[model samples]
Target: MESLFSTMIVLLLVSLSCFTSSEALKSNKGNITIKWDLISWTPDGYVATVTAYNYQKQRSIPSPGWTMSWSWTSKEVIWSIVGAQTTEQGDCSMYNENMPHSCSSKPTLVDLLPSTPFNQQIANCCKGGVLKPGLESAFQIAVGNAGDSVKTVRMPVNFMFTAPKQQYVCGPTKNVRPTRFITADKRRVTRALMTWNITCVFHKAT
Candidate 1:
C-alpha cells in the first residue's frame, strides 16, 4: 500500500514537470525571423539578401527603425550593400582605394530612408527600418573575403536585434533549404545557392 502511494506522487510530479516544460517551450516560440539567402556566388565571396519579418499580429517596429548587429565567424567584409547600409565603415585603411562598405568584424546595419534615390532601391527595402505587423524588410549585401561556396561559408553569430522600447532574443542560425523564386514572366524558376534562418522572440521588458 505504501509503495502504491509513493508511485502516485512521483507520477503527479512528472505530469506537472511535463506541463511546465511544454508551456516554457510555447512561450519561447519566435514571433519574428530573419532569413539570409545566398543569391549568387561572386568571384571573391557572394551576394545575399537578408530579410526581417515581423509575424506579430499587432506589434510593429516604428521609426529610426530596427538595428541588427552580428559578429562574423570569420574574416568577412561588406563590399557593398543596397536598400540598407551599415552604420559605420570600420577601418578600411588596409585598402588603398575602392574601399569596402564596412570592415568591422561586428557590424551594425539599418535601413535607408524612404527618400533614397530610386537607383539605390530594391524590392521591400528602404523603409527606414519601420516594419509593420505581418510585413517584412530586406536588403542586399555583397560580402567580400568570405567563402564563395556553401561548404566554406561560415554563419555570423551573436545576432542582436533592437527596436524602440522592445527586446528581442535571437536564436542561433539554422541552415535551411534554398529559397526558390519564379521569374516575373512566370516562365522560369530559380533558387538561391544557400539559405539560413534566425528567429527572434519578443520578450516584454520587466
Candidate 2:
C-alpha cells in the first residue's frame, strides 16, 4: 500500500508539471507581429510594405503612438515612403539629386497623421499609430542600394517596437510564404516576391 501511494503522488506531480509547462508556452506567444512583404521589384532595389498587427483582445495602442526601428543588413537606403515617415532623415548629402528619405542604416519610423495628404496615404495607414485590438497599420517603403532580386535582397535585423507606454520583445526576422493580393474588382490576383515576419511580444517593462 505504501508503494502504491508513493506512485500515485509521483503521477500527480508529473501531471501538474506538464500543465504548468503548457501554460507557460502559451503565455510566451507574442501579441503583436510585424510582417515585411516585398511587393514589387524596383529598378534600384524593391518596394516593400511593413505592417504591424495588434492581436491583443483588450489592449490598444493609444495616441502618440508606436515607433519601430530596425537595422539594415546591408547599405540599404530609403528612397521614399508613404503612409509613414522616418523620425530623422540621416545624412543624405551624398546624393546630388533625388534625395533619399533616410540614409541611416538603422531607421526609426512612425505612422503619419490622419491629416496627411491623400497622395501621401495608403489603405489602413496614416492612423497616428493608434491601433485598436485586432487592427493593423502599414507603411510602404522604396529601398535603394539593396539587391533588387530575391536571390540578392537581404532582410533587416534587430527590430524594436515601442508603444505609448509599453515595451515589446521582438523576434528575429523569419522568411515566410509570399503574400497574395486581389484587386478591388476581384478580377486579378497578384503576389509578393518574398515575405518575412517579425513577431514581438508584450513584456511589461521592468
Candidate 3:
C-alpha cells in the first residue's frame, strides 16, 4: 500500500511539473500574450524571456487518396484560396503572341501575412524559443503567382523553427524556409522545421 501511494505521489508531482514548467511570449508591439507549457515540450536551450511566431502551420498526411489525393483537403491547415498576390518575375522578356503559352493550368497560391483586427499571437517558450528579426520585424511570407484553373494554391507552412536564412536552398536541410507541407487531422505534424532567431525580450506594462 505504501509503494502504491508513493507511486501516486510521484505521478502527481510529475503532473504538477508538467503544467508549471511554463513560459510565455508577449508581443512587444501589441499587449497580446502567447503562453506555452514548456515542461511537456520546449526549445533545446534555456533562457527566461518572451517570444512569438507570427504564425505556424501544423503538418499532417492522410492515406494516399484519402479524399481525392490530388486536391488539398486537409482542414488542419488554415488555407485561403486566391490569397493576395503579386508578381516579382516571369513577365517574359517580351510577349510571345505566336505561342502565347498558357501556363494558366497551375494554381497560383499566395501567402499573406497574418493581419487581424487584433494581433495574431504565437506561443514561444523562452528567449531561446524566439524566431527571426525579419520574421517578426517584417512580414515572413508574402506573394505567389499560381496559374489559373488551379484555383487553389497549397500554401507552404511548416512545423519547427525556420533558422535565419538569406538565400533559398533545396530540400529538407536543417534551416528556415518557406515550406510546402500539409497537416492532417490526426495532428501528426511533419518535420517541416521552420525556425527564427529572436532573443526574447520582456517588457512589463507600464
For model 3, the run of ten residues with the poorest summed lDDT: 61-70
Q: Arrange candidates by TM-score, descending.
A: 1, 2, 3
- Can you rank all candidates by lDDT, best first? 2, 1, 3
Poorest 10 consecutive residues of model 2 by lDDT? Answer: 21-30
C-alpha lDDT score of every prediction, in listed order: 0.88, 0.89, 0.25
Local accuracy of candidate 1 as per-residue lDDT tens digits, 32-75? 78999999888889999999999878788999899999999888
- 37-77 in candidate 2: lDDT tens per residue? 99889888999999999987877888999999999988899
Estimate candidate 3's alpha-carbon lDDT, on a 0 to 1 scale. Answer: 0.25
Evaluate model 2: give its lDDT.
Answer: 0.89
RMSD for each of the candidates: 7.1, 8.3, 20.9
Best by lDDT: 2
Candidate 1 wrongly placed segments (more than 4 Å): 1-30
Listed in order, each prediction's TM-score against the native is: 0.85, 0.85, 0.19
Q: Candidate 3: deviation at residue 67, Å?
A: 32
- In TM-score terms, candidate 2 sits at 0.85
